[model samples]
Target chain A: MSERGLLIVLSGPSGVGKGTVRKAIFDSEENDFQYSISMTTRKMREGEVEGVDYYFRTKEEFEAMIEAGEMLEYAQYVGNYYGTPLSYVNQTLDKGKDVFLEIEVQGAEQVKEQVPDGVFIFLTPPDLAELKSRIVGRGTDDHEVIEERMRVAREEIEMMALYDYAVVNDEVPLAVKRIKEIIASEHFRVDRVIGNYIKMLKEM
Target chain B: MSERGLLIVLSGPSGVGKGTVRKAIFDSEENDFQYSISMTTRKMREGEVEGVDYYFRTKEEFEAMIEAGEMLEYAQYVGNYYGTPLSYVNQTLDKGKDVFLEIEVQGAEQVKEQVPDGVFIFLTPPDLAELKSRIVGRGTDDHEVIEERMRVAREEIEMMALYDYAVVNDEVPLAVKRIKEIIASEHFRVDRVIGNYIKMLKEM
Candidate 1:
């Protein structure tokens, strides 16, 4: 029997290095997993490409997709509309490729509601101290901004309990390896892998 | 923070090579997990050591342990009493070591009743044809016995849907590797690993 692709939802607190982890998974030849590119109303940055990094769109276009229920999950971040297009996700799965979606906790929950079969993974920092250090070490934020980020981090960390699995980003390589292993093991879940076997046996 | 141990219950059909996969986990230095040796009233064979292979006991002694509420799950098989001792399993977990128990499906359900936190894994052969071949290749079972075993195997495979996860024994090394990855991923379950952090944050 041919194996179907998997829908993997990754949610974590900011500064947990999810982007780095996602890049590594994409780079690993053993993965063969696809990344779900999101559509956003936010203007593309200097190096960002339309349809590759994101589907850059105008506010009206983003609103039209949201009204038509074309987006799996959408939200207003800062002042721009950001959302996942369901059509693209379905197309990827149709090609028998595992799809990964990097999103926030609320968006992840929304996707889970639409696709209960999706696997949810939450990434975490090794500890609160390490998390604070990472946020500050980025040098993009001052002490006040770092404090504000930590406040939000605490709230997000509390939501980690809702995830199916948690991986600490203490060491990048170990975390990436563990996440890959989780994705591989999830494919062998009994309900998905054994259904056809049972049907065939019943026919015999 | 110190990591806690998990109680894992593995159940599967005969000839699925559950024993081999279970042994591979113990043999791996990365596991650091322990297996729960069962207590049985069956006569000890040569080279069997008490408290190592099994806790060999008299029928009367086994009955007493049951009466005292010391047994986690027990049943009569071939006129011999076999059971898991609660003390041994608890002691292992209390020391922060994951414990795996290989038991029949019925016994696994019984353990689940007592310990609702236990993780259940079901192993299966790659296919029915492969299963029959494995049983016949054992060379110990006659044709009649092998036929009966195959019938029972069919019934057991039907119960795969009830399991938390199922691993197909396509190849010994691959199956063992998958089982190890499952164990590793389970350790990162958010409810178990992040509860303390969440509680601490709330208190703060």
Candidate 2:
């Protein structure tokens, strides 16, 4: 195996079971896979652990990090700051762990500007009805909110073409299996293995 | 699952166990995979099947096929005319079966020109010593032939960057697993699945 670890940016529509699939993977034998905990200005809800849930920061602190170019991508959604920390990504990768990032399409696009070759995977619901039902089943949002979410999700899905792989989240285990396959094959990429293979050939 | 099947081209150096790994894939429960039997003008060696091994053709037959553009790529190797039949690939893929083409790097390059999106995977030995031992283990070739093979192997391996994926044949099971992943991921490619996803979204 190569010393370098994969940086996987996993994105999809809001209703897609990104978190469920992410947990399914980590819950497997792959304990070495690192999760990128984003820094956010959103107030920590009840039972939410600080570091595990998010690195809760104030607006000023998050802005300062942005000013220093430490944040890979930061966006204000519903007046709350959420950003992927570049330091965390670099430090995790340096530790030789495959880092998984679950983010929205916009944040993924921003991260792509910095990490061009990062494995971008888009998880999708089996169909629009499944997506709608999943969102409605949450019961946290009203009809108006659900409708708005549906509209935004269609736009988000339109950007699926930008991703390298798109797995349908019909079943949790199946989705996790596809993701594992992606990570496995990514290591065999020519750009990643060419240098080491060439060095060994020269030594021989 | 997507209706369209994948077009996979597996290539590697001569000493690398490309044939072994390919057989291992088809031997599995993956009956949907179709292996391309090349048409050749070479005299059938002992124990070689007619169509299963290679489509035995006369020089005139092979030349006429080339003139008719029936051959996707034809190469004269050691006074033997070998070529991949374009119609075979299209017919197999049209029937919703993944087509596997095991070819040399030169022939792979030619096929890529016709099937631009074909998944090109390169298999390699873990190290030069292993590759050399594999070559020497085959008592068929002389020292001069073995040395020339080594040189050509290195040259071919250098073209790894042209491939979409590269798997080191350290273990048969592991290599087959990686290739399976590559095939799985290739099907999940945005170009292949996005159209269906979009259609479902519109229907919703």
Candidate 3:
């Protein structure tokens, strides 16, 4: 059977080390997965590139795309539209490369309805204590903000049931290894094979 | 969350080399996996151990186990009783070890109903021609027997959709690699996590 690309939705609560685990996988020579570049009306922060970090767009441009149903999922945050555009993900998949969309849990829920076959993964810390420690370790936020992040994390953990796989970020290397295996094994899923192989076998 | 064991069911068409792949994994030192030793009333072949090859039993003994619901799945084949005993599989799982059951498609189906959580895998030959060649290469079966085996293989391939994953036995190493990944990735399944972690998070 011919190979097809996978749309992987990587999400987690705040301070779950999602970025670190994803970075390790992307840097490896295994699959060379493409990260979906999001579009945002928010101002680009320091060291952020126009296309590499995000497709910085005007409010009018973002609104037109939303009106045309071009965005896969979008939301208004702090008076700016932040959303994932579908074209880039489609183009990468057409070329037979997997796309990793690192989104929040709510955004991931939206993408699931649109791409039901996408592999949704939830990253998790080892425990609530570890999650709290990670947030405190960031060393920027004060006690009240850290407490708020902890509360939000507890709520997000409840939504882990919606994901297809839940990889614990206990160790970065181990978590990345498991994610790679998940991608490799998912390629041989029976649903995909039934769709393509039943006809091929009949011809045989 | 605490770790639990996995029940892995491996099956394939006659010439797809299921034995070779399962042997590779069982012999590996990475994970201590237990092979579910089957019970058979058939006479032991040369070089076959009572427990290793099978828990050789008399017809009365096998039937007694079946009556007691001790046999996971049993069938009378060629005037002999053959079946998997549930005690061995459950004991291995209780000790936190993965259990591998290599059986035919129908046996796998029976086991699926009994233990619905098994990771059922169908190992496929690269193509029908390759499968025919493998059967002939063994040089034991005559032309008529080989032809009948091929017919059975076709029927078995049609049932592959009932499996959770299908790995093409194009090459032994590649197929074994895929199966290993399947085992590793299954540990992170969200359904298993949801069963345990939901309560753990609630406690926090």
Candidate 4:
């Protein structure tokens, strides 16, 4: 097997339950991947450990890292920097540990540009009608806000073209199951493992 | 999901336990695919029902079918003809049922030429040393014969480059599991299922 581990990015349109599915995967007994921790310039909570919960850094440090192009993807939220550290991801993969990242569609796009071989999975709603019901059932947004969210959701879904697999999140367990199978199957892909076999043959 | 079912071709070098692993897959409770029954010109043995064990055909009829390019792949063995019928396989796939074909490496190569989209899985031994021991452990062939067989096995192993996935048949159960995962994953491949999602997006 190649010592380099797979970088699996799980993302989808908003409200597709990407977080729920990701949590389920991590909680499963068979989980063997390292969850990607984000670096943030925001103040860490009392119980949050630096590096464990988040890689807490000074605003200046975050900005410096950004300037150095160390972050795989970053975004400003409430005036705080938040992003994935590309160095950590690469180090984990170099150690042959698979890394799992759950991000928004835009973040995923950014990651794809940097890591072309990453396994990108797009979690999807069962249908547009189901998505609308879920959004309405939230009982939080007003009609206009809900409509705007829907419009953005449709646009994100259109970005499915950029993903490697679109798994329907009709049920969290089923989606997790499919994701796991995809991960396992990817290990045996001819392009990934054939080099070792060819080398072995030559040695023989 | 597309109504067209997957055509899974499981093959490897001789004595790689392709038959055992394939049988295990079918024997499992989750087996849902149609086993591809081969057409043969040899006379049916007692209790071997037509179309169940094999599709019995007269030599003339088989030759005509071969002449018409109806056979997916065929070979002459012990003065009898044996091959998979392309029409039956296509009809089964058109009915939205997966077809599993356990065949030799050469036959699998021919199938690939016909069904480029077929899921071609190469079952491999854990290592060449282990393969040699397995052949020696058989204790049925002379040294020259064993050498010749090993040479053929090496050639077939080289053909791994032509496959979609190469699974090590270290154990029948483990190999079967990997094969199942490969089949399940192939269904969600971006190239295969993206069209449906794209169509749904257009309709929405």
DockQ of each: 0.45, 0.45, 0.47, 0.42
lDDT of 4 by residue, A1-204 (tens): 445899999998888899999999999978889999999999989899998999999999999998999999988889998899999999999998999999988899999999998999988778642554554667887889877766765675568779988788888899999999999998888777776655644543
Clashing pairs in 4: none
TM-score of 2: 0.83
What's the lDDT for residue A153 in model 1? 63
User: Of the pair 1 and 4, which is ahead by DockQ?
Assistant: 1
Best by TM-score: 4
Per-residue lDDT of candidate 2, residues A1-204 (tens digit): 335777999988887888888888889885567999989999999999989989999999999999999998878999999999999899888777889998888898998889988899998777642554555667888789877866866776777878888888888988898899888888888888777656655554
Give the per-residue lDDT digits (tens) of candidate 1, residues B35-153. Answer: 89999999999999999999999999999999999999999999999999999899989888999998888788888789887777888767653553555667887788876866876
CA lDDT, every model vs. true structure: 0.81, 0.82, 0.82, 0.85
- Chain B TM-score for each model? 0.82, 0.80, 0.81, 0.86
Who is ahead in TM-score, 1 or 4?
Answer: 4
C-alpha positional error of residue A159 in candidate 4 after TM-score superposition, expressed in Å: 1.4
lDDT of 2 by residue, B1-204 (tens): 336678899998777899899899999775468899999999999999999899999999999999998997889999989999888888889887899988887888898888888899998777642554555667888889877866865776677778988888989998898898889878887788777656655554
| Candidate 4 runs further than 4 Å off | A128-157, A202-204, B129-154, B201-204
TM-score value, chain A, candidate 1? 0.82
Candidate 3 at residue A50, lDDT? 92
Task: Name the lDDT of candidate 3.
Answer: 0.82
TM agreement with the true structure for every prediction: 0.84, 0.83, 0.85, 0.86
How do the candidates rank by TM-score, highest first? 4, 3, 1, 2
Consecutive 10-residue window with the lowest summed lDDT within model 1 chain B: B127-136
Local accuracy of candidate 4 as per-residue lDDT tens digits, B1-204:
545789999998888898899889999878779999999999999999998999999999999999999999998899999999999899999988999999988899999999999999998877643554555667987889877866765676678889999899987888889999899888887677766545544543
Better of 2 and 3 by TM-score: 3
TM-score of 1: 0.84
